[model samples]
Target: MPTPTKTGKRTSGLPAKTRLQWSGLSLAIALFLFPIILPISGLDGPQSRMLGIFLAAICLWVTEAIPLTATAVGVIFLEVVLISDAAIVPVGADATSAKVYFASLANPVLILFLGGFMIADGAAKYGLDKNLAALLLRPFGGSARLTLLGLMSITALLSAFMSNTATTAAMFAVVSPILKALPTRRARAGVALAIPVAANLGGIATPVGSPPNAIAIGALAEKQIYLTFAGWIALSLPIVLVLLLFSWGVLSTVALPVGTQLELEMKVDFDRSRAAIWFYLITALTIALWLTESLHGVASTIVGFFPVVAFLATQVMDGEDLKKISWPVLWLVAGGIALGVGVGATELDKWLLGSINWQSFSVLWLLLLLALVAVGMSNVISNSASANLLVPLTLGLGASISVDQGTVAVVIAIACSLAMCLPISTPPNAIAYATGTITNRAMLLMGLVVGILGIILLAFVMPFYWYGVGLLPVN
Candidate 1:
């Protein structure tokens, strides 16, 4: 219906090729009709209907039939319009139960990320990320391997408390030029690929590091299983440190040919402007508050907004800066939260969870199974969607199994965070793919290996590390 572009290509077309379209549409239709035509899989009318909706949501999310946010919104609309009476309605009648879906728009996890987006946008706009990256990368001066490690370290350190996607983009901006200055493309690939992986790994270190972590916390909070900011750092920081080192080797050896090295250079113009100084001070204060949240009993979600207040009050970030906030990402997270809410309200999650035979598997085995499924699902769909779909069900399953639900919650979060195999897997992977330095084959192969390694580490190492952090009972 639209005119062709000046370049002679159609401006509007199907989002995917015909084959993909056929496959996706067929799958989506099949899922929609599945519950009606077949056995209910032992589910009742409401549970069967919920399963159909869940499958439809998964199909839409996976197929690119529409935008993910649209799919999420459609889920809420369908719930309210056609299936309201089936929802929990613990607080109100069928008509008002729709409020449950809308309530997630203001979910605490969404608020934290909303505030985080503003801070990250300000940091990027003011060149705070660059200034900081220059300082950190300069110390390794001249050794490509060390510089690569340094870049990953800084990226991980920042992502531990910030947005992984923002951190990956910022780090790529800072490091791409240095990599380009090298003799060949092979050398550039080393740090380019490693930065995103590190960003992903770093996000596991703190609750605020990644959305999945926040989702896990929010779901567990319903059951009174709490994990402090410090507690999360204790549980995940070691794994992050190991992954950073291991992934650096993989990029340097497997992704890039051995003997590839760059004389990396990081130069700083050293901006000491009032705004820059304020940026540094407020950022530091924010990190301190997030890290020490337990001591003050202030929720991190409450502390997250401090940056918005500090930056605006000091005029470090102006109205224009506010315009760049990741509003779409907030919407996306909100939609995912709302989907989780819908699952809870329908009791679909509880019914499925209760149906599982939990007595057969030990706690460690249960942890591994959940992690595997989370990682697998995240690879195919958006990680936030993966978390929303799985965490509530996982929490219910964990409690039913009589295991420490908090421990299972952490494992699931880590598994979701490590899904980096494809561009569709996570925002960081997509950002790295945009660099044009890595190939689909390279990313898929390397990401698969790294994802496996991370899962293995999580399975074997988490129990001991968790025990040390007091999140797990001594075996």
Candidate 2:
């Protein structure tokens, strides 16, 4: 018989993960009960209850004791039971209707994201993503530095439309041959690092580019500040381009030798089938409509449903494709929306802001604080969750301080996407780390520099630019 061997790492006791879950869950529960069991000084009953929900949400989202979506839905459920009109213990007759909480699932922003998801998934299903990558990279030539630039540019462009995680995965597949042909592991690591960094930066360019953007938009809509698709691109695309080029420079200096050559090859085949043709047309038209929202005056959310109708009507994307959409992301965004509604309706923001002296805090310093907090939290938690927690608070601050609601929301959203310090920072980073081509130390080094640069740009440089361009409230 084989001898039983003893491993030093927790062979008999509860697993580490299970223990973490229980601890996190316990902390969340205690937070939820704190506001209710011991009332605060100035907050009323509804405000106190909503405060508990918000606190608990922060704990649950940061710890991820439950799935992110589960925590999201749990927030909505708690709002309905504790603060809404359907509350088991009524606060007052002014409680919001339960339907208001439920409406978050079908919020207009989620509809817009649904449309984006369909187009992105359809691109993957029809091979448009890879073909586009191949077509676009042809212009960059065969030098290692130029090839790196091309790879990042294409990845960023794709990520602007598709999800960042999906964009990173697709781009990696397209560039795997190049990665393998590199003579040094440093070159390979540099090439690999570019994809995720670019994807993370690219996600700030448009409203549907990532979950944080959508969350920011949804929160802004509640405050009567709307941003069109084209408007968002106009606001953020410059930042994306600058960051992309900066990251490329960092990677090139660190990884590629002065005169290295790279061989590049890609095969592009367009689908000419009837369904594919219709999908292609619909995709183009939908994008055109989104970009021209200023001219047509149709809300982006209304235009968002165009593809849903066109694709299904033309049989371009069937039921299976519909089922494959990133529903969890949509639900997560919805939860954020619901949380915003509950907080606003219950006057929780007013209570939270009441304690702070906004008269002494300059708008620049306040914006700086929000951006820094967003970057730090996002590096350790989900970007969307960080944005979900921060955007609404920033919106509330607009009324109390001399800040532009739209500018602050956009700042927090962009900062959330800027975090990429670890394997767990974002899905794109995790994907790159999983490939075994890049080490954690390398990612930390690169991600830290990029994140700090981004924060500096956001706090000092971008605000001045926005002010010059009339994007911010001129003092």
Candidate 3:
């Protein structure tokens, strides 16, 4: 019913596109609908329905196929309105309990953890993060590899207690200046890419390092399998160290030939000695608190509060800068937590378990499939959402295959953080991409290489170590 425009062009009520683009869209649409047409050959009921919703959500997320927040709301609406029948309900009548549905939003631990992000934001605004980076990189000004190590180490250390996005943003601010000082374009590009890659890689070191870790930990605890700080470290640290080394090797081998090293021009105006002492003391105390949680019977959330209070009281950051925090991210995480809890509380997990044909697949094979699916899904969706959707599925798969459910669940959790392939893949990648130092092609190539390496490392090494350390029971 559309009319022609003033120029005599037809208005089909569709966005303008070239013929080739239209052809591609047509092909994509066909491919998308292929599964739906062949009903008998398609996925089982719960899985088919869930996959349809998940794919739709992912398409919207990846292509801006729609507004992101709107898509998230759409997911909730679809689940509540379209899929709320007895067959599709997650917790059944109990799942709809106001207490469980809104639990994540009201969770005290989650709120306290959200406050940590505000502290990090405050640190970034006041230039404290820059000061810290400068102090760390000053000694390594003459050596490229040492500079890389310093940056990686500092990022890893910071990520242990702060969000990876906050750490990447903070480190990017400091590293950008150093990159500009470099004489060669190649060196600038290489360091720019490496900084974010390091930040993302470092995030696997701690439970608080990324949302996926937090969700996995929380989900497991819901099942009554509590992971202690020491237990998490035992399972994760080796994976972190090995992956760090692998990443270093890859980046080092692909080094850009340096033409000239820049003179260290930045002056240290901040009291490095005092800041270093306070930072270390606070860091040590925080770690101690996490490690001794079983003895104190105190939650990590309660322990995390002390550092924020100390950081504020010591004038490390002003109260006003705290407003810069990503309140939306906090909300997003809370929403995800609530959604995940709802899924578990309902019969959704059990339904998924009942529907899968696990007798046809081996445990190792299933785990590999999950790893690949997770990495691919994360590339399109938020890593948190990817983990949230996949964790229940993985847990369900594990039970069907007779594998240790906790181990399989944790593996998927850690693997979800392995999104390194694109700008939108993870926040650290976005921050790095924003610098304009590296090309999208270069970032993708590097991320592809590193991502594969990470998967191989996690797939083989993590399970063995987890079982050996007693964090996971032998199956």
Best by lDDT: 2
Q: What is the C-alpha lDDT profile of model 2 across 337-450, one tens digit per residue?
A: 999999899888888887889879877777778888999999999998998898876687877877788888889999999999999999999999999999999999998999
lDDT of each prediction vs. the true structure? 0.75, 0.90, 0.66
TM of each candidate vs. truth: 0.86, 0.95, 0.78
In model 1, which range of ten residues has the least summed lDDT? Answer: 87-96
Give one digit per residue, the lDDT tens place, for model 1 in 1-475: 9768789987765365467656876887789668846867566554565577778877877775767677767777666654465354222343336666666667776777766777777777777777788788877765667777788889998887678888988888777678667666666666678878888898889877787887888777656667777777878888888878888887766544545455656777666888888888898888788889889989887888788888899999888888887665666666666666666666777777776688888777777778889899899887877876777666666547666767777788889998888987888888988888878887888788888888887777777777875775534
After the best TM-score superposition of candidate 3, give how far the Cα of residue 97 lies from its true spot, in angstroms: 2.3
- Each prediction's RMSD over C-alphas, in Å, is 3.8, 4.3, 6.7
Off by over 4 Å in 1: 1-46, 82-96, 183-185, 253-262, 472-475
Q: Poorest 10 consecutive residues of model 2 by lDDT?
A: 7-16
Q: Flag clash pairs in model 3.
A: 90-346, 90-347, 91-346
User: What TM-score does candidate 1 reach?
Assistant: 0.86
The best candidate in terms of TM-score: 2
